[model samples]
Target: VLKDDLVYVADLFIGIQIINVSDPNNPTEFLRFGTTGANPRDLCIYESLLYYSTWYGGISVVNISNTLNPVEICHIWLSDRIEGLFVSYPYLYAANLEYSVSVFNITNPSSTYKMTEFHESVLVFDVFVVSNNIYLAGYAHGLSIMTLDKGGDLQEISQHFFPNHHHSLVIDEPYAYVGDKYSGLHVYNINCVANQRISVSLLKAGGFLALAIVLIKLSLKLLPKILEKLSPYKRGYGL
Candidate 1:
């Protein structure tokens, strides 16, 4: 989580580290807190409170109002492991390692509660939210796109599959860049999903054009041989 010149890092074993990047060349660690128990997997900052997810289970909200002495305001325990976190205004989305993305009502910040969850069979590694859509990065299931309905229920929009396991993802408008475990990085054109019918039509047209070209070439090669056999008397019959 980035706030002004300070960057809060979720150090797995060492807890969350508050680093001061006032100097670009040489940055120093200001403070490291929340190192008591479970490993911090991910962290998100909303207002003055910082929410950090733990690997063992649940998330802890810390009061970062005083950078020198941070205080733990609230702790909410949920899934087996919280891999990633994303906060959008009053709601906080957590990617559970078990199989789902849990949503929390963080309107009160300190007194937050679970609102809803989008469940799936795949292992959710990370989550990214944009507008009303929530994108989930899975271990072997690739990516899952879902939308928040009027009743706050999660509705599946579509799913895109890839080869290796997806560790993380970042969406920039029409494109999504996914980080794979083995194959490095993968870039996907998400805009095509909206125009799927048009894309399929274009692909079908291209296939037909390619087939026509192949048939024309074969006819050009075979016509001479057919003519040679038909007009045995004259080689240049003009027929």
Candidate 2:
């Protein structure tokens, strides 16, 4: 029930519903449309359009310029079950349970065309776009970050795994909020390139510790004169 600007939500068992939330407490259910399937899992609203992915139905696009009378504009059939969807500029991306992520060109909303697909072993549960990058959450694969190539092709940038099953992810500013089934909610700081380095460091801390110990051993093997020169003070040991 987000009430800042507009309200967009998927009312499972009912349909994709949008409410006029200008009055917050007095939110009016303005649009209701039955989907081809039962559960409307997730949806996103952009400008005058609404994109939804259902548990059974592939994908649905609706025009909500007139809030009172929203119309179904297009529906794209998927090869497998879909759980989440996101729309950015002229593109739409869907997370499919068939262990893959699908991309579509939505320049012409009425006639969308498949752009590309990436296959994985784990189900893709949710996805979100930030700038030109796509962040995907997989049931077993954790997080996958991808970008669009100059030719509009999908390219994998990086992927990392957490301990629990990844369910959903939301990118806000320089942070990414991940919903892990067993871990509850996890917040990540995405402020700098150092963050990626920190993630890597955390992932291999055991090996790093071993390497530090080995380096200390190697340093101890140095000659007395070399050790003295490497020390902060020449023959003046700190108390």
RMSD of 2: 17.6
Instruction: Give candidate 2 regions above 4 Å deviation.
Output: 1-6, 191-239
Those runs of model 1 whose alpha carbons end farther than 4 Å from true positions after fitting are 35-37, 195-239
The residue-level lDDT of candidate 1 at 76 comes to 85
**Ten contiguous residues minimizing lDDT sum, candidate 1:** 230-239
lDDT of 2 by residue, 15-103 (tens): 86667878867988776778766677777666677777776567888887876677888988765788767777688888898888889
User: Which tens-of-lDDT digit does each residue in 105-202 have in candidate 1?
Assistant: 99887799889987888899888777787888888777788888999988888876655577665555465555555544455666755543111111
Instruction: At residue 8, give the lDDT of candidate 2.
Output: 66
